[model samples]
Target chain A: MQHTISVLVKNEAGALSRMTNLFSARGYNIESLTVSTTLDTKYARATIVVTHCDDSVIEQILKQLHKLIPVIKVCDLTPENSTTLELVFIKVDSKNEVGELLKIAEAFGVKVIDVSPKTYTLQAVCNEKQLKSLVELLRPIGIKDIVRSGAVSINVKSE
Target chain B: MTNKIITKELTGSQVFLECLKNEGVDTIFGYPGGVILGIYEAFYHEKKIKHYLVRHEQAAIHAAEGYARVTGKCGVAIVTSGPGATNTITGIANAYLDGHPLVVFTGQVSASLIGNDAFQEADIVGITRSCSKHNYLVKDIKDLARVIKEAFYIANTGKKGPVVIDLAKNVLDAKIEFEYPKEVDLEGYNPTYKGNPKQISKALQLLCNAKRPAIISGGGVLSSEASEELTELAKLLNVPVATTLMGIGTYPMNDQMALGMLGMHGNYWANYAISNCDVLFSIGTRFNDRITGPSKEFAKNAQIIHIDIDPCSISKNVTANIPIVGDAKIVLQAMLEEFKAKNYEINKENKREWFEQIEEWKKQRVIPEIQSEKLHVHTVLEQIYEYTKEYEPIVATEVGQHQMWTAQAFNFTKPRKLLTSGGLGTMGFGFPAAMGACLADKNRLVLNIAGDGSIQMNIQELATCVEYNLPVKVMIMNNGYLGMVRQWQEKLFDRHYSETKISGPDFVKVAEAYGAKGIRIKKKEEIIPALKEAIEYQGPVFLDFIVEPFEMVYPWVLAGTPIDKVILSRKE
Candidate 1:
């Protein structure tokens, strides 16, 4: 099972490295991680989406995270009526592949954001699985560049 | 919101010293280095706190552990950055494993060059996080006082362990307002204090109904200073008491109700009693794998009741029928009160036969064999005990057969007199620990009994004793091998001694090189004379006794084997 956990932590140097090291040390597979500064100057929020772990194992990982000095709060937003998003940017061949890419992007509710002489940039805001499939489809059509903002999640209601 | 009287500006070192004074620290063990020069300068003029310059940072930490173990007080240690900090890792881990209260301070590179990999810049906090109960990397001068206070409080409180405070060099030099925090406001640091009343009542009821009840006390009781309450409860219930290695000093070893240590290398009688008891109450011990050998068959006839300060330890190793999470002192007091309320009667018939059986086992199995002219480990231990019997000296030992022999032969009638690295089984813990123990109670004699192999691990501590003019008598049982490991191989591995053979420089010469009195005892009759001469010396003394090899610690219960199947002695 996959778990998407959101953590609020103090913005300090080596904080990210410590979290990543913890996951590596425990042999936990982190499929996706996205971190950003919150509106508060003192705090940074990290949304981590991990896969192939049981609920109990995830709970123990969360408990260990809670023990970290900088971590203030941790919440598992999965199975809790939450909203999740993943943004992906891809540049495809505009000369010949633009029409086919646009058709596929339209099918997946993606938007064409930018165009160049030889390439076109496609923007996608969708679930992780959909984003992955869309990227795979655009890869064979001459993908010049690709960037992905790993999954971010929030619960439907207040904590 | 309120005006306050401004104090004079002070250097970081002065502020650090003031914080320690405010925390009521009387002594600290440390070695000065380039990074910690500021702290050293402050120490030169500090009159309130006495600082002992240990030979090595590693020894400093172990000495601190020794102080904590004997006094139930928070021991403090200071070391410089990089190598000095790294040297203290083993001692820190040992204290953490043994749950000793210790506060360690390490100097760091200047704040400006912290991340630039400057000279002597090791991330002490990052390296020690897993080993310490808590740790802090102080970057700002203003946070020093609160961090120091919190470090002491955390290290000395519930399930006590070592805490490290890594101070940046620039922070030590920066000026700041000094104000110690009266109380900590940590959100996730609450430790459970009161055991569940319902569980306590249930445990009491179980004890009331048990026909053969026993209490297995561990170091937790000693850490909590609950020995008095534990003895009262045991006597009120007429229960037999057994101690783990760490709990040796918690109860009077000579008490008839005491079954001695119980574990892989424990007394046969104690192991048998634990295996045969109807109800077993374990307090302040995490049932280590060595103690519960083959958990499936451990205490097969008993219902276990485990009481520990940490809730996670309850079911981590052995499953407990009744688990009580609280401070050992508080829980034991409540149990004593409940026992008083119930007016519990002693199960005289059950205890009578059990005690008789233990005595029988002791007479047949506990006695060591006198084979030939060669001096045995037990004989050496007996000689030491005989010599120190009148003075009631403090005995600290390194791990192995020598330690067990001392524990078995020496009659410790009082608490805090027998100090050893029990939980950590740390080698080289004896010499420095003995030194620290002597510092704590200077009026009494301090004896360090150690195996030759174990002694070599931290033998450098002899310099510390010599420097301080501490008269610590060290007896090294020299068998030219790792005696304990060889014994195990002989018993369990078809007598295949692989890497047990040990060869090294003359220990006496090594002691002499370190400017300490040295003596060697080869003849059987020279043991007492050598010990007396060494004891009479005004400074630290080392006695190396080249005892017989292949002399195994007997009445040994082979690992995974039952207590009843113990091998008493060699047939030859």
Candidate 2:
């Protein structure tokens, strides 16, 4: 199972390493992670997508994170309770299939960021599922390079 | 008086001592070196805090641990950077796992020279990150006081552990206006001291309903000073109390309900009760691999109620049917009140069968009593215990066969009476820990039961003991081999000793060279007299007893085996 955890941590020196050390020490897999300053300068938010952990492991992960002195808050985000987005840039080789690539990009609501004779770099902002589908559709056309901004999450209130 | 206003300027070194004074620290275990010269300079004229200079950087921390355990105050130590800082890692890791509170200051290279690989520089904070509760590198003079304050608070609070403060050379030399903070507000760390009322009520319900009840107390019982509460609860419920290695002395071993200790080397009846009990309520013990033979099989017939201060420890190794996350002292007190308020009757008849079963297990296959004429460590330990029992002496032990023998042989009757490295199993920890224990209380007879092999690790500390006249008796069990490893090799590794066999310098000569008395008991008849002489003598004494080489710790529970499936003797 996978869990996207958002951690608000104290913005202090060695805080980032301390937060990451917990995952490394436990041999937990960090599938993807993004860290940035929160609104308050004294703290920072880390959005991490972890793999291969169950409910018990998640509970342990949260508790362990809370144990670290620099960590301020930990939130285990599920798709239902939170809004998440991942930005991925896919550079296709084109291979004389420019029309097909553009069609595929448009269907996923992706933008044609760059174009060249040899490649077309398309940027997609969507959930993990749509990103996976977009990559699968472009794989046959040939992906020259790919880069992704891991999950960025925010909690949503229930009405 | 209150901490005065921050108007007076003080050197960083002065600020350091003042902060310690504010925290009620009067003693420090430390070693002076190149990087820590500034602090030493400040100490030259200081009279309030006395520093005990240990021979090795390692002993300094270990001694602090000894001091901390007996006194229940966070131990303090200071060491120079690079090798000095690195040497304390073992002690730091040892305290971290055993749940002892310590505040260790490591002198670092100047702030400008950091990462440039300056002389005597080491990235101690990064090195000790995993091993310590939390660590700090003070780059600025202003953060020094608060860092020290936070270090003490963090070390002494929650689960209680060692916190390292890597004091940069410049930070120590720089000037600042010192004002120690009265409170530390850490956002991430808030230990649950008061358990959830509903969960605790449910636990009480389980206790009230349990006919075959047993309690497994861990080091937390002593850490939270809840032995009184634990003892009361056990008496009220007519429950037997089995303790983990670190939990020894938390419950008096002589008590009828006391199960001594439960683990791989635990007593037979205790492990049997763990396997068969209907309700196994445990307090303050992390169910480490040693405590649980096979997690799935452990307490299989029981509904377990676990009380722990660390939330992560609950359901970590074994699932808890009712988990109350809180300090053992407070939670157990609450449970006692709830039980009393409800007026739950002690069902003595329902528990009669359980007690009878335990008694049968105890009589069936007791810990083996060898009738051999050859000198055994057990005999020497028994004599020492017999002599010191009336005094309520403190016993510390280094890891290995002797440590287990001490655990088996002694009847510890109070909390913090048995101080050993239970969690990390670090060898060479006992002797220095004894020095600290002695320093903490001059009234108690502090003894370090050591192995011939393990004592050599920090033998240089004899000089420190001699200089301070700490009167720490080091009783070495000389087996001419690392007995525990030899026992395992004989059984599991096909009689190959490997590197287990060892011999060293004459301990009598070593003691004489360090200006301490030394006695050797080579024959079986000499054990009692030598113990009497060592205990009665004034200064430090090293009593070396040559014991049988092949003796093993019985009631050996193999990994993945059920707790009840223990080998009673060597042949089994």
Candidate 3:
């Protein structure tokens, strides 16, 4: 199981290390993690995708996070209960299939950000499932480079 | 008194001292270095605060923890940057896990040298973030006073734990208008001291209905000073009380309702009761794995009511049917009051039947009486207890078999009488902690009951104790091995000891070198005289008791097993 967790913490030095240390020390797995300053630069919102933890373990992990002084808040955003988006940029070798690459990008609502005779850099903003599909479709053409923004999440209700 | 407002200017160092004084701190455990020179210089002119210079940074923090445990006040420790700050990590983590109220001040490199990795610079705040309950890095000189005040406030209040304040070298020298905050408001840290009324009602109802009710009191009961209420409540309901290692002094050992200790190395009768009880009312304990073996099988027949200050602790390891998140003192007091209001009293006749059943279980296995040629560890501990029983000594211990034996042998009737590293099980905590306890109250007898392996861990603290003239009796039970690990090897590993065998320096010479009295007893007959001589001495006394090498803690419970399935004797 995977859970998208949004943690708000004080923007202090080593806050990220402290959060990540808790996960590693407790043996929880972090699939992907992304952090950025919230509205107030004094605080940061860390969007982390934790995998292989059941609901109870996830709850316990969140409780442990709450014990840390720097952590202000922890929220678990399940797929059905929240909205999430991930931005990914994939550079595919488009030596001869430039037209096919553009068609695939258009179908997935992706933009062809950059292009050269040898490669096509495509960017896509989508949910986790759609992002996986886009990567699978581009793999045959050959993926030269790929980078993901992880996932930023918010609950449907203001909780 | 007239209302007069006088404004004064002071350096951050001066403000730091003033804030501690305002908090009624009379002593500090510390070490001096380059980054902390300003604070040290300020201390040179001070008369109100006494500073005990420790050998190592870790000892300073452990000493503070010992002081805090005895006095029920936040202990303060100060050390310098980089290595000095890093050395306190183990001690800080020990205090954090065991819930000690400690405030540690680590001198940081100047604000300019912070990120540049200049001489003696370390990200101390970053290093200690995971262990400390809360930490602060003072960037502005003006925030120093407020930070110090808040550090003390947070360290001592609401389920106390260690807090760290990283003082930049420049901030200590900077001049600032200082005004300490009278109060702190942290939105994220509002602890519920009062238990929910509805939950309390439901818990009482369950207890009244339960035919086989038992209580497992933990360290929280001691921390909150709720032992009196706990005792009263146990008596009123006729519920037998079993304590954890940390809960040694939370209930009087003389009480009939007392089932000494429970879990691994716990009493057979106590573990039996916990396993068979229908209603398990746990107070102030986290239900650690050691206490609740095989979480699923633990208290299988019981409906549990857990009362604790930390909400996360409830249903953490074991499920709690009724969870009341509140301070043990406040919550216990509320429960007692509610019990009184309801006037639902236990009939003595019915309670006697329950006691009779527990007594029948207790007689099932008798503690083996060994008539061995070598001095037994239990005999040595029993003599120490017998000699010091009248004095009502405050006992602190290093982690191992001796720790468990001391917990079983010593009789503690009140809270704060015994301090040990329970959660973290740090080996070197006893001696320095006893130094702290002695320093906290010179009149009371403080004993550091240790093992040969553990005493050597913080052996350097002997100098500090001798220098301060703190009469902390260090009783070392020398068994020539790491007894606990050896026990496990003998049981589960087919007796392949593998590095468990250990030796130590001549403790008598070591004590003499540190300018303290030393006594050695090889024969069982020498135990009483040696203990008496150590007690009568005016300074720190290090007593070495050479005991049987293979003596193990009995009634052991292996991990992942049922609590009731305990190995009663050496033969299994």
iRMS, all models = 3.5, 1.1, 2.0
Per-residue lDDT, model 1, residue B335, is 84
Give lDDT per model, in order. 0.84, 0.90, 0.89
Best by the TM-score measure: 2
Fnat scores for every prediction: 0.00, 0.69, 0.34
The residue-by-residue lDDT of candidate 3 on B370-391, one tens digit each, is 7568888888888889989999
| Residue pairs that clash (backbone atoms under 3 angstroms), model 3 | none
Ranking by lDDT: 2, 3, 1
lDDT of 2 by residue, B1-572 (tens): 78976587888889999999999999999999887898999999899999999999999999999999999999999999999999999999999999999999999998889999888888999999999999999989989888898889899989999999999888888888778888887777787899999998787778767888999999999999999999999998889999999999889999999988988989988998888889999999999989898798899989999999998899888989999889999998998888888767777888888888888877845455665666877778888888788888899999998898799889888899899999999899999999999989987899999999999999999999999899999999988898888988988899999999999789998999999999988876787788788878888999888788888878788777888888888768
> Taking the tens digit of each residue's C-alpha lDDT, what string does model 3 give over A34-120?
999999999999999988877778878888787766788888877788999989999999886777778889999999888888888
lDDT (10s digit) by residue, model 1, range B362-471: 66555566666778888888878888889999899999989888877887766678888776788888888888888888888999998889888888888888888888
Pairs clashing in candidate 2? none
Which window of ten consecutive residues has the lowest lDDT sum in model 2 chain B? B364-373
TM-score, prediction 3: 0.95
Alpha-carbon RMSD, each predicted model: 4.2, 2.2, 2.7
Off by more than 4 A, model 3: B1-8, B343-353, B369-371
Residue B89 shift from truth in candidate 2, angstroms: 0.4
DockQ agreement of candidate 2 with the native complex: 0.76
Best by lDDT: 2
Tell me which residue pairs clash in candidate 1. none
Off by over 4 Å in 2: B1-7, B365-373
